[model samples]
Target: MPTGSGANQATFAGELSVDGSTVSIRRDTDVASERVSVSLPAVVSVTDQTGEARYPAFKAIMGAKKKPIQTMSLADLGVDAAQVGWSGASSKVVDVSPTPARTAGTIVNDDGTGAAQLADFLAGRGFI
Candidate 1:
């Protein structure tokens, strides 16, 4: 995002310790890293770096198995079903089409003009 890594974000956010309802999330990219603060009631995805996961014991598993499973719906959660998928999303796939078939690439022969030809090819493709 804006820092280099989660380590950088953590270092910036004081080990990600939040003082209020807002929580800091680590957003990272190759060129940058960022510390983003999301308020309560927001959707968030956490990583193992955030905290350690406690394994369930056999007794806990048996107790969970005995408990009746509760089924919940998006409606019950005050969420519309359509709002979660691609259709009602803020971003959408405007169009999609099958990929064009691959064609044979131009070859550069060991001729004196090979360098010039390669340069022209690269320049034509905006790769120069």
Candidate 2:
């Protein structure tokens, strides 16, 4: 399961339904959340807003630790080496460049005209 940004990315990847099933995100000027019931055999991504995590019990944890770890290669999984890893990757990085520096922002000091200046700034930015 994924959440928040992960959920959004999964939606873009077509892995999960757009906006998810259990957790739906509605965005206008800001983001809003809602509960939606979807069919089974579907992917559901959650967000921090959902709830806290429930840690496994000591017995379950001990059992998990006792479980054997199995490692397999692409050949063992019936996958071709050429069909996986960087060699099989569909995309290639042609070049890399540093990000452009950001311009300085207006600083609003708490002067008597600060409120007016802020309003003007907001209006100019279409955020008013």
Candidate 3:
């Protein structure tokens, strides 16, 4: 399985691999987490929280030690290195501030009267 986790939170992306007998799920790892590889045997069904049965064959390939995972540089993949990562990311956030609190509005006392008031307000604003 493939998972991403840290000190305060974790999120599972999906399973890394599964064979007929075993399944590998991804999970978030903390700084102290260890990497492990295990073997699993013949296929079966996998169900998620929504009660949907997953077709094993349609699942993605699981990660394994036997197969080497190659890490290639962006230039190696035919992408310009200068246009990747921090250099390529658009829109930098300079600062963030909390929004001002809003004041309370007058409450409608009558349902029938409120409907007409609402319609007039919306109409004046060109919303209706």
Candidate 4:
């Protein structure tokens, strides 16, 4: 992961490591790159920095077209129809409202004192 927003929410069910037998996760940091390995039968959620996915070759695509695909319904998976579909949802949304409009911002012109004005604005907003 590239340490982007919400990156800290990434988690795993098993022990995370730099090297292991089955699976591994690679992430980029501010100072260095990291590699985390996990045992077999593990689930990994990666970020966008993992790498560019390679396009499937034409032959592979053709082969995939010839493969048989099995489609199953919830009942086929031993699940009740009313317990998994939208009709069986536990909660309902009664109403929705639009977000409030934002107020106009303070614009500072470059008059040799722009830096000071910006510092003051940030301080007033408790950002500094």
| Backbone collisions counted per model | 7, 0, 21, 2
Pairs in clash, predicted candidate 4: 1-27, 17-37
Give the Cα-based TM-score of candidate 2 against the true structure. 0.48
Each candidate structure's TM-score, on Cα atoms with residue i matched to residue i, is 0.41, 0.48, 0.29, 0.53
Question: Mind giving the per-residue lDDT tens digits that candidate 4 earns over 60-98?
Answer: 999999999999988787878888758799998899999
Error of 2 at 9 (Å): 15
**lDDT at residue 119 of model 3 (Cα atoms):** 83
The candidate that wins on TM-score is 4
Sort by TM-score, top down from the best: 4, 2, 1, 3
- Superior candidate under lDDT, 1 versus 3: 1
Give the alpha-carbon lDDT of every model.
0.67, 0.59, 0.53, 0.67
Q: Write the per-residue lDDT of candidate 3 for residues 7-125, one digit (tens) a residue.
A: 22222423445456444545444553322334443232222422456554423344343567789876677888678778988878899999999998656777678888888878988
CA-only RMSD, every prediction: 9.8, 8.5, 16.9, 8.4
Query: What does the lDDT come to for candidate 2?
Result: 0.59
List where candidate 1 sits over 4 angstroms from the true fold. Answer: 1-17, 72-128
When 1 and 2 are scored with lDDT, the better candidate is: 1
